[model samples]
Target chain A: MSDVIKLAHGDGGKFTNELIKNLFYRHFRNRKLEEGIDAATFSVNEGRMAFTTDSFVVKPIFFYGGDIGKLAVCGSINDLAVSGAKPLYLSASFIIEEGFPIDKLEAIVRSMGDTCTRAGVNIITGDTKVVEKGSVDGIFINTSGVGIIESNYKMKTIESGDQIIVTGTIGEHGTAIAIQRYDIKVKGNFKSDCNPLNGITENIQDLYPYIKIMKDPTRGGLVTILNELAELAGLGVRLIEEKIPVSREVKAMNEMLGLDPLYMACEGRMVLVVNKLYAEKVLNRIRSLEGCKDANIIGNFDQEASLKVYIENYLGGKRILNTLEGAMLPRIC
Target chain B: MSDVIKLAHGDGGKFTNELIKNLFYRHFRNRKLEEGIDAATFSVNEGRMAFTTDSFVVKPIFFYGGDIGKLAVCGSINDLAVSGAKPLYLSASFIIEEGFPIDKLEAIVRSMGDTCTRAGVNIITGDTKVVEKGSVDGIFINTSGVGIIESNYKMKTIESGDQIIVTGTIGEHGTAIAIQRYDIKVKGNFKSDCNPLNGITENIQDLYPYIKIMKDPTRGGLVTILNELAELAGLGVRLIEEKIPVSREVKAMNEMLGLDPLYMACEGRMVLVVNKLYAEKVLNRIRSLEGCKDANIIGNFDQEASLKVYIENYLGGKRILNTLEGAMLPRIC
Candidate 1:
């Protein structure tokens, strides 16, 4: 394939078909994705539940480790997962710019189909619109997902003495995208933490039903999510800076960019607030997963304050962590 | 307000509130919208039906007479309505660029709510993500709409001898956006035909239940839609150019741009192919609607040698109307 895209890719003709078959399907091969229908269909346990929708418009459609198609499917599935729901179906809509290489568009769609298949979700419907050159920048994807949450499992607030856990290393996704954008070279190895968290959520929820809140630290990162949890629960959060996991490469990249690692995005990670007693159990369960081998309890909820997030340094210094005023690494998700 | 946008607009704070109340809420004033909730929920008649999603990334955000927000809501709703469904719930997702004015974002959201209300649909769910500057243009909106189509209404092929009618005018949306892009001036007035068409579809469907196909010519225009219908039904479409209504202003603008009015997009207009015997009644019913005063019978389906779209020129010469290989006006939705 050429380094750049052409308009023939979005034509929905011969080139579009070949592109899907070769690049995207090869990586994201799955049974449901092979159907090649507009949408994937599957059964769900009967219930009325919340359905959410989201779109991915990240620049450089293809990033360091993941592309926009993969992001679209995984990001939407994560939203449903955090809502305490089992993602069932997904609908994708594409607004492709004219002159985008057909091969690229196919690669994106095939990757999307593969990602959804791995998540055990169906892409049941989709619409495609082609815009002329200059009107759009390459391609943008929108996905709407429907999931069923068990009526018994209602998302609740974290109480005092609850533990806060990070699924894995933070700032991988953000650092990866940033490095790609700036063309920065780092000595150490790094990979984007881009993976679906539904299976892990399912395993944990099946074991401990009292998981108070679950959030994927994406756009605003761990700092923003923790603040939201504190504000929602009307409690204070105390985090141990040392306990929170971060790769040396990610930290160095952040420092180089004069950025806060806490504000950087992570796609394959999650923050969970559970009773302190089950904190160890939750951490162990998450660690058993493929991508969450470094899961750890980094903080606990405090009853004294209304809505505050404090990070304790290794030298016994405490600093307040504020909610992100604006996006730190926008469109990282 | 400053021309350059700031981060506070998306903060969900005072500046964001002011932006909503002053700019967006002022233009799109409505009760449900004024609530300022994350989502607006409403009930609909329960049934098994079709659900679709669409996103509008129209450049310049605001065009001739309409904006991206209005198009987002109306586009998805129209898709459902044309599919023989009663438009119901909608979900809107936004990807706002960092530094975008909060006022602009709020204006888009409020317009979406107002447009949904006018179309008799509810905004049930939504999502917001902010990207860093340079990642995306101003703003992009993704809307997923769920609608209930009566079990009795089947969207199948139209039989031979079915009469095809177009509501109001064609090419208005495309012409308006093009003129704005090129800064072209016309003596006669030209307005974007960006009104919602649920009412017109409802009235025409009520009058002629045998309406075989209904589609709003938005991106590919009327010619592409006719070609699709003809190909699907294995028939030919014959159109009379003299009967197809085109505003004088749009004609002049098309001439100036060297664009074909037949291939130009129309946001508010729809093409309906009905049984020949009920064609007049359907035409009368559409003409009685507020925005469909100029509805007329402009074509018919024929069992010809090939599934082609033939247009009868004003001088009585016949020419083949082909599908647009590329978008006429990018992001004109």
Candidate 2:
């Protein structure tokens, strides 16, 4: 009966039932969720859909721009969104360390509910399990979401000559978390660019119609994503070093620490491959959207049938962008 | 580079990418998962679908009947099955402890792959994250599944006069786990009842057409689930104590350990509410199926608008079956 969660709350007995009714159900009240069973049954819109799952083990649980809850919701939502899906339903499962504060858990759950509202999705059903204190760090959340891809926007490829656009200033999320994790004191008004990207994508529906491929540069960041795409499409990408957006503070930290921002994680930004005809139009439309004022057509598919990624330098020299190979950072998402 | 898993394997950089391409791809190769991105895009079979998620942290990872990997797949698949869905695509995420053996991880993933194969589902996409050595136990898996429902069997309630039938002997999953966790020696052929219930349900569909509600007796077990139905339907259930099936070994262990089988988990069994007119027919159909040879009609909804569960004894006495209120067993799933 203490306010803190006990091992019994996850034992699938009465305590678990009460915890669910008092905490999760209190925040995620909805018709499908009201059934309150193992799996939530609901109607799905007919057509193509995207499904994604991500586990958030971001240390400290609470971060500068968002907590693990917000990160979980937005992360999965962004995955579905960039796939041209209208993120709809989500299921959240939590692995909490025993002795975790109930107040903090409630706050995280409330944040998740709020994020779902902002992203136009519902948390239908979920699971919670508690482990011995040392068995887990505070808490880890794994969220899986299902979304209906808008038929008209179920876009396709990264053909040669297509322009590649970086949705906004890169590496803000990676920088914000890095600063906090390392306790580096060099400061500016730095916050994670951790917000839902679906709304912004919806705003540019006219341009979305022209885009070929869309993806959120999350864990491995922009460099890894570009390499993966180029390899998959058997094409080479040519990005201008000066054209990609980076916040002044992040750029300063990158230079000072000898870090590459291209490999840093970004929780909210996206990478798009659109045809040259709509390149400027897409960039202009994204610039008008909030959180995307720094949108730029940073690169292009420079070659066909060549699995390579190259960066054009400020001095007009070219360097190959190799796929990131090892851990520069962990749990940035 | 050693045989043990390193942190870099989950760093979302090069090592992580290679792990996915080599290990997971070799086991769960499927068309839907070939995209290998943040989200897997796929076409949906129209109509209503069931969405469910579960995180498995059953301690001692491997047990008599199945490991956490198998439990993860079957658990989520069963949730969707009980909701009348033909489980389809699954998304898996892992929180691995640093220094865990790569062979063990591979075994777990292989178990997941095999379970999905048995359940007729595909592992379309997944994620991996490695936390520092004590931040997590050896491993924890979270699986989310999307499945299509045979609309005809999509059911509603536990009405008065509905027959309650248990698919098979209960308490095996809980007992198997308890014996392992406590290192008890109860010499007998023991294994967790961890088979996929979807195929069993599908086999009985012709007779299951009369069922009103179906649910897996997982966390709360038979007693808790029966109480939940009574409370939800605002009805009282009456059961013949001797009719409820219990395996001889588990029953003996129950009496020897002062444990109640009614509150024990059964990973592979289901609790069903069916019209009295079809109870015997459905029982016959289920009895003819694998894992349900011991199926029996153990109870019935006896009263409307009265939230109570009562059992009739062999000696003509009666007792109340209260909802499980405390931790009898934890993590049996």
Candidate 3:
């Protein structure tokens, strides 16, 4: 059941079949994705479309709560989802190193298929290439997605006094990947926040039309996302540090590693900027989703000239959040 | 001017600037690309769209006639082109190794920008990430493109008696890459056939409204492509070996390496299956293009039961061209 992949795995033959079935299908089994075809097929209602592409090269294929395959699918789908579009199709391309395990590749592909099915998208077309052993790392996946948005459903821009809300906690994905990568042991259990955010976006979009910008706090985390929005909108943002909601485990780990949780990456969480009047309804709608039950308003936009991000401390002191100079955790995504 | 890449090349600052200016922009300079913005913005006629994504990790980044950057842009554009689409926008993502030369990365990006401009496409958005030295090779590029296809244009399937034509010679790309990779010495000069095929496709589409199928021979080469088409159409194909043109140098090199020229990859060339009546016109149109001046009719489809592909040799012998058993040249694309 576990053998290192030979070049035959990519040869489009029996070995490729075994790899797809045994490893990939094993972990990513789902009802709609059982059809083993070159591309998954589906239909969509008429609408204008939005599309996005993302590649996952996370060092360890399998990490805390998710693997590279799952991450690849979710990351791409979520990107399309937050752009106010209903993700419909995805194309996957793989670059596998020569000696990567066929079992591992299968697991990754199956997981990706299952993730797409859950997100209600089809894997329509794909390409696979193999490189010599030293040329590449284990495997790298590039996924491009297409989503349809009804012509009328344009999300507006963030304005002064708009509430900025986050779905659940932050820093979980970064911490999880970091810990698993370094094999660090902690007293409490830790898992990645690497779930899809489509459901929450769907819920909020259904209830209120006043929600402004929505973005996943990925690479530079909540702080960087806020900074980017501030600069784009020519505004400032203020948040209450105590109410920002970081788990004790993440905080402790950040302290241990001399890192800041605010700068960590979160795979599944998103920041929503909404009109102040609709913030309550949006929060309630988001709370009904499974992974976003802890949704909270983290900050508000301000019309300040400085264009800075400030967090009000528990002791009532304001601290500035600066953009990260370099990636805190290199290949976490 | 030629030096090994250093870490500062990917720092997103001063060194990155000089690298882009000297090596890449100097060679591929164009007005739109010179703006040096994160995304290139442009306009297109209104229509439904076809989109595609591709990543290039060809080893020795710099190949015979082209480098990874040009290949990445050309590959994505070609995918859109063959789909009967008018390519408009592209997004490039770069994953740079820690010590890659800033100059090289800049040169590559500029080359990519130039390629996009020549193909009448723009780089609309991009993401850049840097990994530790050992985590990645020199640099890997992922490009996603969106193209506008005329609503009236539909891709047609190949039918029996369709004449298959190949643009120019085959195996030039594979032989060139292989020669550089293995350090093979050949008496005659050789260069990779790595130009974009969108222009040639445009000319053909303009003349023939009924071109059945079009495909570029890349990773698995011409034989695999023919086999795929055969399987898709549930028919057999008969190719005349002498009529299938290849440069003498390439043929000599193939014999030297114990390789078959028919199984080698070609980037710029394409195999087109057209209704027999239009074959001559299509070949003439392709020949009118500078690089495809030698386009020739090489084979024809047949309604045989076996779905096999065969080549008639000069010695009056017929040889089966089977699906490639394994990758003949990894990363040839």
Which segments of candidate 1 are over 4 A away from where they belong? Answer: A1-46, A95-103, A127-138, A205-209, A248-259, A276-284, A288-290, A313-316, A326-330, B1-3, B7-46, B95-107, B127-137, B203-209, B252-257, B313-316
Candidates ranked by DockQ: 2, 1, 3
Predictions ranked by TM-score, top down?
A: 2, 3, 1
- As a whole number from 0 to 100, the lDDT of residue B140 in candidate 2 is 93
Lowest summed lDDT window (length 10), candidate 3 chain A: A37-46
Root-mean-square deviation per candidate: 4.5, 2.0, 4.3
DockQ of 3: 0.25
- Tens-place lDDT per residue, model 2, A281-326, is 8888888888788899998997752778888888999888787666
Candidate 3: list runs displaced more than 4 Å: A8-48, A151-158, A206-209, A303-305, B1-48, B151-160, B206-209, B303-305
Q: Note the Cα lDDT for every prediction shown.
A: 0.74, 0.85, 0.74
Per-model chain B TM-scores are: 0.88, 0.96, 0.88
User: How many clashing pairs per prediction, in order?
Assistant: 10, 0, 9
Report the lDDT tens digits of candidate 2 across residue range B47-71. Answer: 8888999999898799999999999
Give the per-residue lDDT of model 1 (tens digit) for B109-178: 7777678778887766666655557546678788887666653555556888899999888889888888
Candidate 2 clashing pairs, residues 3+ apart or interchain: none
Each candidate's DockQ score against the native complex?
A: 0.25, 0.73, 0.25
Which residue segments of model 2 deviate by more than 4 Å?
A: A154-157, A304-307, A317-319, B304-306
Question: What is the DockQ of the complex in model 1?
Answer: 0.25
Question: Ranking by lDDT, best first?
Answer: 2, 3, 1
- How good is chain A of candidate 1, measured by TM-score? 0.87
